[model samples]
Each structure stands twice: as structure tokens, then as C-alpha cells.
Target: MKDRQLYQQILGITTPWFVAEVELDLEAEEVHVHLAHQQASWPCAECGKPCPLHDHQNERTWRHLDTCQYRTLLHAELPRTRCEEHGVRVVDIPWAESYGRFTALFERLVIDWLEAASQQAVADRMGLSWDEVHGIMQRAVKRGLKRREAEPIPYIGVDEKSFRKRHRYVTVVSDINRSRVLYVSEDRKQTSLDSFWGTLTEEQLDSIEGVAMDMWEPYIDSTKEHLPEADEKIVFDKFHVAKHLGDAVDKVRRQENKQLREDGDDRLVGTKYDWLKGRDKFNHKRWRAFCRLRRSNLKTSRAWAMREQAMKLWDYCYPGAAENHFRWWYRWATHSRLEPMIDKAKMLKSHLKNILTYLTHPITNALSESLNSKIEWVKYTARGFRNRDNFKTAIYFHCGGLGLLPAT
Candidate 1:
């Protein structure tokens, strides 16, 4: 077969362009394919209007997919066009993306590998530098974000992830129903989320029905400032609420353990985990330790009971029943002589309406937590980023689910 025809078949060249020549350097271990345009007139890269050929630009080379063990390259001297409107500019190419030095096919492969591996791994496997791999991912994410669906997102989850020490954080706003990272900004402040809401259209803002988040005042304030029905929409996440309850129980355990130690009793020493163990989570060893505590009349034991019973508040099918149950539990906890538990009860009482919004929405920040875990893995695999922009890019590239692959 002719070299030109063979290259045309290999490179998927179509219409106004064809493989003009092919050169192979055995010593260099490279295949260079030259491309030529068949048409006499050149089209403007920006406007696509046919214009007179102004001049020939410098010959450019693009890295193509490797053929076997040898690197393949595409070389073309693109023509410039003098358009009446767009002025003199280089005409577009068929095989490579504009302003990119790599073929689209090569970039697509890089994107695919990026989904399964880190940028460093992909770079090492593909004989590219770390910056090159990062650039590929950044470009893919840009394309994906440009093409992202504009349909209304009703439910969302907002949270923050620390990318560096010293509380360097980014607020992530994610679609709860779609389970996709929709926006990321460089802080957990009200302005961080305000920036996200600022990008939304009035119709889009009005479409928001619920937002599940932790008890961060900034997030609550931002939602209230932007959303139409913030009171009915903001939902305090169940997991974060449970964490507060657990912290209160641990505080009670610490206090009681301190008193017992003063009384020369070492029974509660090294038993902190015992007080936090869930009712159904105890194994044989933890069960025995907890059983020992259950037999005692310790304040920690009473606090643990209150913590476990608070779990029942989420089980009620109706909002009114859950409200009544929570109120009764609140009264018992506040008067039980346990200051930490009483404080937690008061905190929950303050956010009681937002807590009950859970019954109406049934949405949680579970997906955001899962995404945070994946983001942590990304950070670990990459050994942490040197800056915030790189960290944000890594998170959006991996957890954003942006459908970055090019169309076949």
C-alpha cells in the first residue's frame, strides 16, 4: 500500500485533508506523517468564513498515539487566512485540538487513563511529564465544565475539604440527586458559597428546593441569603448531628473518668472507645467492656444511653411524632445533671427546625462525605498539592464526574 494511503487509514484523515507523506527514522524510533489540505481557499479559525491564503506559518508537530513501541508524530504547515472580518489567523486543523500540541486522540487516551489512575501514574506510564498530565486533565475538565448540563438542580450538599494544613480549605457544592460536584471555591466562608450562588441564574436559584450541610453558620447564612425558602430548605446532616451527640457522650465519659481517677479508681482508664461504641457495633471484646460499663451506675453509661436513644429520633415516620419525641428527650437530657449532654440538647433545640427539614427533604450529605473520602485518597496518592489551584483541579477532575471524555 502507498505510504500516504496507509497513514490516511492510520490517522483517520478525512475530506479537505490527506496524508501527503510519511517518514520513518529507525534510529530515532519515530514515525512522522505530513498532512496537506486539498482546498485552495482557507477558512478563518474563529469565524469559519472562506478567505484568501495570506501566507504559510511555521511547521507544527503534534504528538500522536504511539504506534507499537515507536512514537508517532503529525507534522503540518498550516496556512493563514486574511479574512475580511477576523484578520490574518492560522486556519484550524482536523486531527488536533486548537492551541494543543497533542492530537485529540492522544488527549482522549490520557483522559481515560486519568479516570483510573493519578496524573503522576498516567504521566509515568505514558512517558509524559507531571505538568503535561496535569495540563491534559485541566483541559479536559474545562471542556467538560463548558459542556455540563444546564438543567435545574433541585437538591444539593455543601461542605468543605482541607487541602493543606493550617486550615486551607475549599467549599464544595454538589448536586445531591445527581451526586456530582457542581462547584468548588477556595474557602468555607459565606463568600465562598456566595460566589457559587452568584453564578446561578435567577431561575436556577429559585429551582433549589433543599440543601443538606453541616451546622456551619456560613453555609446556613449563605443559603438563607440566596435561596427563596431557606427555612424550609436547609437540612442539618444526620451524620454531623450524630457526631455532636457522640462528642457530648465522650465529654461525659471524660468527666466521670476524671472523678473516678481522683477517687483512686482505674476502671475507666483506657475505656474511652467503649463509651462511643454503638449498640450493634460491639464485637466480643468491646461487648464485654461495654457490658462491664452497663452494670455500673456511671454517668458515662447514662450519657451513652441518651446518645443511643437520640438515634431513635430519626426512625419516626412522621415529623410531629419525631418532634414530640425530641422534645421529651430534650427535657430529660437538660435536667439530667450532665452539662455536655444538656449543651448538645440546647444546640439541637436551636437548630430543631432545620433538623426537622430532614423529614421533609430526606436528603443528606452522605454523597459529599463519600466524595471527601475520594478527595482524601486523591491527596494521598498525589502526596498533596503545592498550591490551592492544583488541589482544586485535582478534586474537580476526579470527583466532579464531569464526563470529560471526548465524543467518538
Candidate 2:
């Protein structure tokens, strides 16, 4: 086949465009393929109505995928058409999106590389600058966001993650049933989640049935403000509640250990994990050690028992039964003489309805937590993002599960 035909086939040029010429510069190790319009006049980019040729714009060059060992470039004369309805506008090209300096195929290759590797790695491998690679990613994310269909979210998990250090955070909302990130925005404030709710259509907002989240007031407030059935839909994650109880247990353990140290008693020494770890996770030796602690009169021992009993509250089939169990456990914890345990019990009492809402719909933020872990991995892989926008984009790109492939 001739060089022009080979170039045309390689570049996927067809219809309104074709590879008119090929210039192989061995000195520069580059392949320059010149493109030409097949017709003298074409449809307007704005209105899609065929119009007489206004004039041809200056030659524009787009970077293409490498040809074997050489860099490939495509040069074309972009035409402008004056539509009566719309003023003079440049006609759209077939092989590339408007205002893009790289061909669609090249951008597609970059998208695959970005999924597999970091932007820096891709830039290095492709001999492109870091900004160039980031631009490609930004454009790809824009395309993906545009292409994504906004379906009604029935079940969602809301959480916040640290973007950089010093308490910098971003709120992430995930479709729990679909196990994909639905929206992300800066800050852990109510406004952060408000942005997400604002984007949803009325039907989409009404379709939401459940939202699993940690006991963060901002998230709760946002849900109450936006969701019609906040009382019924809001579910405080079990793991988070368990975490508070666990923290209270550890606090009691630390205080007891300190008191024991003062009294010259070594009974609670080296037994931190005994109180925190689950009984099922204990080995024979650890179990024996925990048994000894359980039998002892340490305040931590009572706190541990209370924590275990509270975990059992989730085992009840009915929400009323669970609430009753929690109330009994709350009475025990509040009277246990452990300040931390009392505080945790009081907090749970305040949020009991949201906690028990879990029984009606057993949804957990496990998937959201899993997504946070993956986002952390993405952050670690990229050695941390310099800005919140990049961090948000990275999370969406990696965990959003957005279909990012370009049109063929």
C-alpha cells in the first residue's frame, strides 16, 4: 500500500477527512501526516446545517500516538463556517475533540495508562510534560462526567477523607448498592454534601431510600435538610458506633493501666489488645489472658464486657428489641464508673434512632470505607496531591468506576 493509504488506515481517517500526504522526517524521527477535507463545504459545527465555505483557519497540529520508534503528528487546515443562526465558528474535526491538541486515540491511550499507572509515570513514558498529562486526565474526567448517566441513587454511603494533612478533607458520596463513588467535593461540611444534593433532579433525590454514614453531624444535617425521609433513611454505620465503644474501652484500659502502675500492680500490663480485640480473634494464649482480665476487678474489665454486650445488640432481629438491648446496655455502661464509657453511652443514646435505623435496612459504610482505602492508595501512589481538585479528580478517576473510554 502507498504511504498515504497506510497513514490513512493507521490514523482511522474516514468520510469528511482523509490523510492527504505523509512526511517522514528521518532526521527528526517524526511522522507528519497531513489531513484534508473530502468536501468543499460541510455542516456548521454549531447548527449542523451545511453551509458554503467561509474560509480556512491556520494549520493546526495535534500530537498522535507514536508510529513504531518515531513520534507521530497530524497537521490539518481547520475550516470555519458562518451559520446564519450562529456566528462564525470553527467546524468540528472527526478524529479529535474540539480545542484538544491531542487526537482522540492518543487521549484514549493516556486514559488506559493513567488507570494502570500514575500521571508522572505516564508522562515520563510518553515523553510528555506533567502538566500535559494532567490536562489529558482533566479532559478525560470531564468527558467521563459528561457521559455518565445520572441515575436515581437508592442507597448511598457518605464519608470524608483526608486529602492532604492538617485536617484537610473532602466529602465522598458512594452508591452503596452499586459500590461506586457518585460524587466528591471539598470539605467535610454540610455544604460539601449540599452540593451533591443540589445536582440531583427531584426524582433522583426522592428515589434515595437509605444513606449509610458515620455519626458526623455535618453529614446528618445535610441528609435531614435534603432527604424527605431523613429519620427513616439515615443509618449510622455499625462499625463507627463500635469504634466509639472500642475507643471508650481503650480509654478505660489506659486509665486502669495508669492506676495499676501507681499501685505497683502489673495485672493490666501488656493487655491493651485483650480489651480491644474481639474474643473470636483471640488465640488460646490470648484467650486465657483475656479470661484472666475478664475475671479481674479492673474498671477496664467492666468496660470490655459492656462493649461486647453492645456489639451483641446488633444481633437482635427487631429494631425494638435492639433498642431495648441498647437501653439495658446503656444503663450498665453509664453506671460502670468509667467516664469514657458513660460518655460513649450518652452519645449512643442521643443517636439511638439513627443507630437502630440500621435494623430496618442493614446497610453499612463498609463499601465507603473500602473506597476511602482505595483513595488513600491512589494518594499514596501519587505521593500526595498538590491541590484539592487533583485529589478529588484522582478519587473519581480511580474509585468512581466511571466509564472513561473514548469513542471509537
Candidate 3:
């Protein structure tokens, strides 16, 4: 049968019902669909009036799933209705919303592929522009947000990551147990956290028993202010604490290495140098240097002594020695003549409650970091997000764990 006749037959326009027909133009590499209206009247929304259908308008085409080698376009002759009570209005169709050219299924498919794949990649595969794919994703995000209004998230982890060379940072919050991002803010500030506080109630905050953070003042301040009576105790993650000490140790080691190089100690440059990496990864050579420094009894070897002290500080962090370790550190800090090391130890000991809590409940903000990695991947894959809403939508759809399929 001819394409036009086939389209008319499938559309069933002769019966004057509300349905659409499909026409496959194989030779032209196009599939055209026509939506027909059987009723010529619509009741006014504001005023009860049977509006008469005026005339068929221009063809509105929407991209659809491909048919074999041909691309499909859903074309409909949208009509305007003239009502006595209300002004001229566009007729509503059940297959697609007014002013929306794409079918619901087609939009879902595009958004699904976009959530799993990059915008550019989806555009390239579907022969669409990046803008179109992004538009679909933005719409999907809005829809998802509406559906997720009643979701209950108990434990949330918040952290920040640098973007655009550390000048611009984005704060990300995630569900720790579910391993998904709940939201992302423009800045890492207390105000940024305030944006989502309304999403949770006091009961929810009180339910949180633990919050893992990296010893950032803003996060700590915000949590305290927002959840003043929360049962959640702030746990300074062990990884970050260890990182701080490791960084300090590395700085000291580098200074020592620089001094050796300046003094023409080339014999101690290579093999002897590996001992100064960090206290955590200290080798046999490092242990030997530490022993030598502890036993040297030389006032000039302060750096070597400091390195030994740093090693001892790390040694106190060994597993299964929590009580003994705290006692040892307390005694060392109280009696030590080295004021600098003692000061550091005292500062750490002051937060011993949180530190010991970490030993017992070892939950970290690593899930938040992992979610940030995925957000970074989305940012890089798209090269950039021009629309903030679309960027947010993509993030929520991809990582919100709402069980929403891209095809939905």
C-alpha cells in the first residue's frame, strides 16, 4: 500500500477518534506519523463550553525510534479550538504533551542513554545534537525530582572536591550506605548546606548517630548549628588524619634530603633517601635511621630526632592497642621535653574521643568521594554543562538511586 494510504488506514481518521497513524516512507528514509482528532470540540477549562475545532495547523514532527534503515518522525496536524467562553486554545493530545514534539517513550530512551553514556556520545549515536540530548536529560531530571519528593535518606556524607584548578569547588552530599549522591552545591560553605536542610526534619537529624568528615571547620560548624541536639557524633575520618601526618612527615623528610644534597652526601642520596617517605610506609632502612636518631644523643640532630618522634606517633596508632596507645600518648605529652612534638600530641589527644570512636566505628566519607568521582566523570564526558538545571538532572538521574530507568 502507498505510504499516505497506509498512514490514513493506521490512523483510523475516518472514524473521527483521538488516535494517530504511522506512514513508512522506505524510499525517502523517513517514517511519518499523523495524529487525528475525531471530536471537533473541547470543554473550556475555566468556563464550561464545548469549543469547536477550528482548523488543522502545521505539521509538528518528533523524533522516534528508527525503523530498519529509515528514521521515524511523528507528525501530527495539531488543531486549535474556538470557544465562546474562552479564547482560542490548542487541542490536547494524550500521546504527547502540547508543545512537546517528541513522544514520551522516545524522550525516555534518549535520556536513558544519556544517563549511561555521555551527551556527545548519545548525540553521535542517535544523530542528534548535544543540545537536544541535554534538553531531554534536563526534563527527565525535573520529572525525577517531582517523584522523589517523599524519599527518606537517613545517613548523609558531605564533602568537597576542587574543579577548574582549585579555584572553583563543588560540595557534594551522598547517602553513605547506599553509595549515591543526594545533592551537589555550588560552594563548600555553611549556606550551601542550608539549601537542603529543609529536606530533613529534626527527627531525621536526631536519628543520625554518626557523621564522618575530614576535620573541616565549616562542615563541623554547619552540622552543629543545624542539628544542635543530634545524637550524631562527628567522626574525623582516620584516612584524612593519617594523610595530615604523612604530609608533615614528607615535608620534614624532603628538608633533610635537601640538606644532605647541599652537603655533598651523594652516598646517602639514593638508598638512604628512601627511608624518609612517610611514617606509615617506613621500611627497615627508615627504622634503622629512627633507631640511630633515638640513640645518637646529639643536640645538632634535631631533624633526625623529629623524624623518630613522628614514627613513634604513628606507631601508637597500631590496631588492638587503643587503650594502651591513649595512655602512652597522654604520658608522653605530659612529660616530654620536646615542646613542639608535645604540642602536636596534646592537640591530637584533645580530640581523642572522636579519634577513638573512629577505631570502633570505621565509617569514612569515602562513598561521598566516590560519588564525586562519578560527577567529575559526567563533567568531563560532557566537556562542560551550560545549563545548571540539566547538569543537576543528569547527576540525580545517574546517581540518585531512584530506580528510574533512562527508558522510563
Candidate 4:
């Protein structure tokens, strides 16, 4: 079929709706189209009044998909309608909004691309400005959010991620089993989670069996308050628990290092000092000064012994050995002469109930972390969303498991 005939078929205009005959030029790799309006009347959008259509007010054209290197243009003539309530206003078409010239399907394509790709890239490829592409994304996000509000989630995993270089952070909540985000709040405070509590029904809150979180007290307190009967069992993720022990070990090592420096032990100051630093390298550089103390002439056999004992806690040979290992560690730590290590061991034993829960259900907040990564991607693509409503919608559409397709 010819290009013009094919374009007409794609538009699907027959009799009742108005049609425009336009000529498209793609020699310059840019859209150029001339449209002639077909005289027709449209109803007022506000009051559904059968208002008389005025003369063609203006001709607007938008860049659409390129056909085999040929630029496509959607040209339309906008007309006004005289409504007694709304006065004189531009008529709204089912295919496009009042001020918009592109068809609904065309808008959907832009939004889908925006979701997956960066705004600057989408704008350059579609021959549109960055603001135009962002606007379409904003609209799509709103529509998606509205659809998601119809259904609510039961089990939610709440966690926080850094938004800035320092301590500034944001909270994100997701469905643990479904593996989708439920909501994201601007701040990591209890108030942020409180704001979303209104959106959840009482039955939904009651259905939540357990909530996986870090050692943050605010999160635990808020969860308990909101989900009063929700198992009341907080599973402190293994990673966070391990991190605490690691920090304590480093602290003791630092104290021992200062005492060794007083005795002028220069041999313990350089490399080949793996024993003092331990295996975890996340904060190795910060704790290097303490690692040197391991070789100090000062009495540090107790500190060294505690470090080795702490490392042994992670040693689980098989599936059934976890309980036995926990019991063994309990006995060993309590009998130790080192007070600091004994204190930490006692704290661990106090939380043994929640710690052993991991053996029954070995799930962590890793799924929630994965969802936060996606949210970070969205923030980077748009360079941060100005509208909170639009941001929520975009998160829900992409991570809410709504299975929402683009407008087309």
C-alpha cells in the first residue's frame, strides 16, 4: 500500500469522525506535514452539551514514529466549542487531549520508552524535547498509580537506602513473597511509614505474619504499632547481625592497638596483619590501626581469642548443624574470661528466639533491596521526580506487579 493509504488505515477514520489529508516530507530527517481540517462538531467535555463547533482555531502537529527512516507527523486542527457553563473551550477528542496533538497510542509508546530508557535518550530518538517526554512519563505514572490503589498488599518488607552522600535516606516497602514494591516514602522516619498505614486496611495489616528488617528500632516500633497482631516476631536479618559483631570486634582491636603503641611496637604497624583486621573488608581501612595491635607486646591474648571465637559463629557445616552451632557458641562465649566478648554473646543469646527463626524461614530482606535498586534507577533516569504523585505511580507501575501495559 502507498504511504498515505497506509497512514489512513493506521488512523482508522471512516465517516462519523473528522479526517485530515496531510502530506509528509522526510527528506531532511524531520517531520513536515500539511493538514486540511474536515468541518465537524464536537460536544463540550465539561457538561456534555451538544455545543456548536467554531471555525478551525489552529493547526498543531506532533512527531510520531519514523517509518523506515521517514519521519511521521500527526497533524490535527483544534476547534473550540461554546458551552454555557465552561464558556468557550477547546473540544476534547477521545484519541487525544484538548491541547495535545499526538494520538493516545503515540503517547503510550513514549511513556513505555520513558519507563525503560532515559528521558534524554527518548527525547532525542523521538525528536521531542526533554520536558515533553518527562510530561508524558508523569501522566503515565499517575494513571498507573490510580490503577494500583484498587488492590492492597498484605506482607510488606520495609527498608531504607541512602539518597545523598551522608546519612540522608529514604524508606522503601515491598511485598516479600510477591517480590514487588508496595510504596516508597521520602524519609526513613517512622512518620513516613505512618503515612502509608492509612492506605492499608485492618485486615491487610492483620494478615502480615512477619516483617523482615534490620536492627533499626524505629522500623520495629512502627511495625509493632501499626501491625499490632502481626506475629510480633521481628526477624533481624543475618547480615545486620553479623555486621554488629564485626563492629564490636574491630572496637576491641582498636583499644588493644592503642595499648600496644604505648609499648613502642613498630613491627606490628605494617602489612601482613590479616589476623587483627579479620575477614570482613567493608571497613578494613578504618580499622587498620587496630589490626596492628594484634602483634603488640601488650597482653592481647584475650582480644585475639575473642576475635577467633566470633569468626567461628559463622561456621555451619551442614543444614542440621545450625542449632548445634548456636548452642556451642552460647556455651563457649559465656565461659570466656573476656568481659566484652561475653557481653556480646549474652546479647546474641537474648535474641536467640528471633535469630533461630532464620532456620525455619531462611528468607532475608534481599528482595526488598533488589526492589530499591529499581527505584534508584527510576530516580536516576528522570533525575528525580518533582511530583510525589507521579513518583508513586511510576514506582507502582514498574514494581507493583500490576502487569500494566502501555496505553496502546
Q: What's every prediction's RMSD, in angstroms?
A: 2.1, 1.8, 6.0, 6.5
Estimate TM-scores for all models. 0.93, 0.95, 0.72, 0.68
After aligning candidate 2 to the native by TM-score, how far in Å is the CA of 200 from where it should be? 0.8
lDDT of 2 by residue, 35-82 (tens): 987577778998899887788899999999888778999999998888
**How should the candidates be ordered by TM-score, best one leading?**
2, 1, 3, 4
Candidate 4 on 104-148: residue-level lDDT in tens?
767878767766787788889888876687667556655666676
For candidate 2, the TM-score is 0.95
Better of 2 and 4 by lDDT: 2
Total backbone collisions for each predicted model:
0, 0, 2, 0
Q: Which stretch of 10 consecutive residues in model 3 shows the poorest summed lDDT?
A: 298-307
lDDT of each: 0.85, 0.86, 0.62, 0.63
Considering only N, C-alpha and C atoms within 3 Å, which residue pairs clash in candidate 3?
16-38, 112-406
User: For model 3, how does the per-residue alpha-carbon lDDT over 12-109 read when each residue is reduced to its tens digit?
Assistant: 33445333556667788887766566676766534647777777678787776665656777677777777776677776654454566566767767
lDDT of 2 at 153: 86
